[model samples]
Target: MFEKLKDLKTYEAGKPIELVVREFGIEPKDIIKLASNENPYGPPPKAIEKVKNLASEMHRYPDDSFFELKEGLSSKFNISASNIIIGAGSDQILEFAVHAISPKKVLMAGITFAMYEIYSKQVGAQILKTESVTHNLEEFYEIYKEQKPEIIFLCVPNNPLGECVDAKEVFDFIEKIDENTLVVVDGAYQEFAAHKDKNKEIKPEDILKYKNVLYTGTFSKAYGLGGMRVGYGIANEYIIENLHKLRPPFNITTLSLAAAIEALKDEEFVKNSIIKNFEEMEKYVSFAKENNLKYIDSYTNFIVLYIKNSTQIAENLLKKGIIVRNMASYGFEALRITIGTPEQNDKLLNTLKGMIS
Candidate 1:
């Protein structure tokens, strides 16, 4: 019976350090994983201390509505709590968006995050993939007119590729789309986007301009809170209300909510993380230039480099106790590596230099 379930495709996740250690018989301490774009600095000290203090109350269930977390985010973004909804992570909110609107046709870029395709299939939607080496608004508009999709997913500062659509262009595209269609801007990497004006960061007020627009973000990347899985979405209260109807009660844990509240208040943590990412990105760029390897300019915490035999390169690196992402699944001859601390970046660059030589 299991064999007859042929409507499935495998989703490849970043290989865990422990699993790689066992597979290659290497010491975990010796491995340098540049695969997932995680904050190397870890969570802020204040957030860690707060969670530790909250640990004693483990027996109590968390607020199912995530009221405090939502309140904090709402205050920061200047939106009513009614317009916000928290989840285990922004990925869950992305899944909710797909589930709510994409019962049939879904549209996304060909090289966007894998989760978009995964969730599309899960909801039994036909994913219409478009090609984009860059986010040319005209190209997107052309496809939008043809597809007339119920839901269009846009990952600004697109993953793996790390290119974002300009704000004015994105707004223009939204204006042209049919009012009945829902347009979602996935901002998982928005924290690192290099908008000329810093104010380009998505604000709750921005989401209100377009009734069909929904913006999602997470604390996993810049906040160094991946393990906690806290993320949220902003939209008109109507859409948020509908999402609340579909979301599971108590989907987020108490500790996660507590940690996120502290994390949001630690503005210094976010500032330092962005500064560190930029510094590390420069080093990666220098390494790529010195080695004569082609790569994409990134506004995110990871950079993608084009290389022949990316899978073979990854396999060899794994044996050497270095882990990097291979883009074989996304049909690109490239690898994506997270920008780590300066020390970790040096180690990764040194290892890559030797491998390529």
Candidate 2:
């Protein structure tokens, strides 16, 4: 076994409703899982219909070329289909980048997504991170000058922390970096960020000018297609060509491809999900303020609250069939709660209020 594999801890995902049922004996209908940043409304109706309609076609393999899906993404983003590479999920695209670069060192924000570090470690790369929990581009640039890392990961509208950096600032910072270093811009939450602030939007077409940069996006967030497992990366032709070399044929299911394609056409569904997300999110902000709790202003579907006894609170919530993420693994006394539906949020808020008071 590789030395890194011996010590590597498996990535811990949020507790699924099935697992909660098995462990806590909670009834499925009674549970409101706000642990994963899933769309509370679920996948788009069009996607649901597509998946249902394609149920009989499960025996057929998905188009390995992904021509239609790529075409849809290209039209939506105003980029060439040649510039796109589809993945099982954006996480798989991250894996391809790590393998392709075979980097000696990887750089990322101190407390962003965990997969970046996990994937890098699998290839024995030394992981580097910014000192600040939130993204600080100045620190990143300084470190880049000193370290000359082979790969740098910028997770815009950063996960867990729920903060985003301005796109102009990011572009300016990238302009200073050496071309030998590949910059991976993970915008898994970009749809939400762009809806919240126009300046936070980093267009694939705008970034495609740089051969060294790759922008990754997923339909799983705002599109409400988390189960579909569809994601893609947009870059200059050269980058996409190389990444495709590592992709497995028919990596996505036939149903997933169709669902994503249909989800792309349902603009109203995505818009409503983002709008409802922010509307529900405001309630969280208000609850935090009314209770005098500190929180990061969220650009994404989830919010992190810096609270006392977060572990205890999380445990209590879990007992009551309300699933929320405890930030103890990230070394913080906080809770990262996904914004749920109106009724679900009320249940969480009322339950939380009693515990804290």
* TM-score top scorer: 2
User: How high is each candidate's TM-score?
Assistant: 0.95, 0.99
- Candidate 1: deviation at residue 197, Å? 5.8
lDDT of 2 by residue, 1-357 (tens): 576688677888898999779888989999999998999999889889989999999999988888888898889999899999999889999999999999999999999999999999999999999999889999999889998999999999999889999999999988998888999999999999999999999998998989799999998888887888889999999999999999998999999999999999999999999999999999999999999999999999999988899999999999999999999999889999999999999999999999999
Q: Write the per-residue lDDT of candidate 1 for residues 1-357, one digit (tens) a residue.
A: 655225657667778899888899899788888888888899988889998999988788898878788888888888888888888889899889888875577778877877877887877777777776556667777887987888888887788787776666777788999978898888888878843235345555677778899898999988999989988989998899998887998788878888899999998888888888987798978888988889888888999988888899888888888888999887778899998888888887787777788
Query: For model 2, what is the C-alpha lDDT against the true structure?
Result: 0.92
Q: Give lDDT: candidate 2, residue 14.
A: 92
What TM-score does model 2 achieve against the real structure?
Answer: 0.99
Deviation in Å, model 1, residue 329 alpha carbon: 1.5
Write down the lDDT that model 1 would get.
0.83
Misplaced by over 4 Å in model 1 are 1-5, 194-200
